[model samples]
Target: MNDNHSSSAWSTYSRTVFIAFAMIALGLIANEHRVHVLGILPWLLILACPLMHLFMHHGHGGHSGHSGHDHASHQAGPVQPKKEADDV
Candidate 1:
């Protein structure tokens, strides 16, 4: 395999492993102690980052409604023949 491909693959693998470890650590910490007023909000934010990123970046941009208006103008308004059948 090319070096670029190998490097990208390794990077993706490392990112996945890092996220997994973070989630596991969060779960362990949350489970071991009683919920606290200060920790609650921050923990929620930490858990929500992935979902917020998914929606803000990946989810909304995939919809084509924003570009559909451009397509409407390109369509032929109506078919018109140069000469009527009676003219032939």
Candidate 2:
């Protein structure tokens, strides 16, 4: 049913948002304090992961049909043939 479908969609969306926020939170915490061991690198990397994902996945809306061509140039009449004057 439509209701079930919508519910599932909402749940998925909520989960994704939660995970995104959690990643940011962890990153912020890591940035606040330095870890003595090599583990800090991995933690910072984890924080950057979500940002990379977002930028890589962001979508631009579809383009209109007019984008590819120059409408004005097409509207102009075809080039006229040039007549050469006869040699005197």
Candidate 3:
């Protein structure tokens, strides 16, 4: 029931934290061999940049409200509004 679901969520969270820490530890070990790593660093970055740009920005998503218009240079020069955000 509720207890089972709560325990399951906690277990998943704990496992995720454990894996994150393990990765940090592995990264530190790799950093110790940074001299060897740096030799391929530039090549890795050159390859990754294009791949990430292509994959990550593949989808143009639901910003349908945006008309792709540049209304910055309107007939009415400028209008500054009051602060609308409520205090937290």
lDDT of each candidate versus the true structure? 0.71, 0.72, 0.77
| Residue 82, model 3, lDDT | 81
Candidate structures ordered by TM-score, highest first: 1, 2, 3
Error of 1 at 67 (Å): 50
* Predicted candidate 2 versus true structure: per-residue lDDT over 21-45, tens digit per residue: 9999988887766555466778889
Residue 57 alpha-carbon offset, candidate 2, angstroms: 50
Model 2 alpha-carbon drift over 4 Å, by segment: 6-10, 35-88
Worst 10 residues of 1 by lDDT: 59-68
Name the candidate, 1 or 3, with the larger lDDT value: 3
**Distance (Å) between predicted and true CA of 45, model 2?**
23
Top model number, lDDT: 3
Clashes (candidate 3): 0
Worst 10 residues of 3 by lDDT: 58-67
Q: Identify the runs in model 3 with alpha carbons over 4 angstroms from their true place.
A: 1-32, 61-88
How high a TM-score does candidate 3 get?
A: 0.30
User: 1-88, model 1: which lDDT tens digit per residue?
Assistant: 5655554645877989999999999988877775575668888899899988877775343356556444543465977778757765
Q: In model 2, where is the ten-residue run with the lowest total lDDT?
A: 58-67
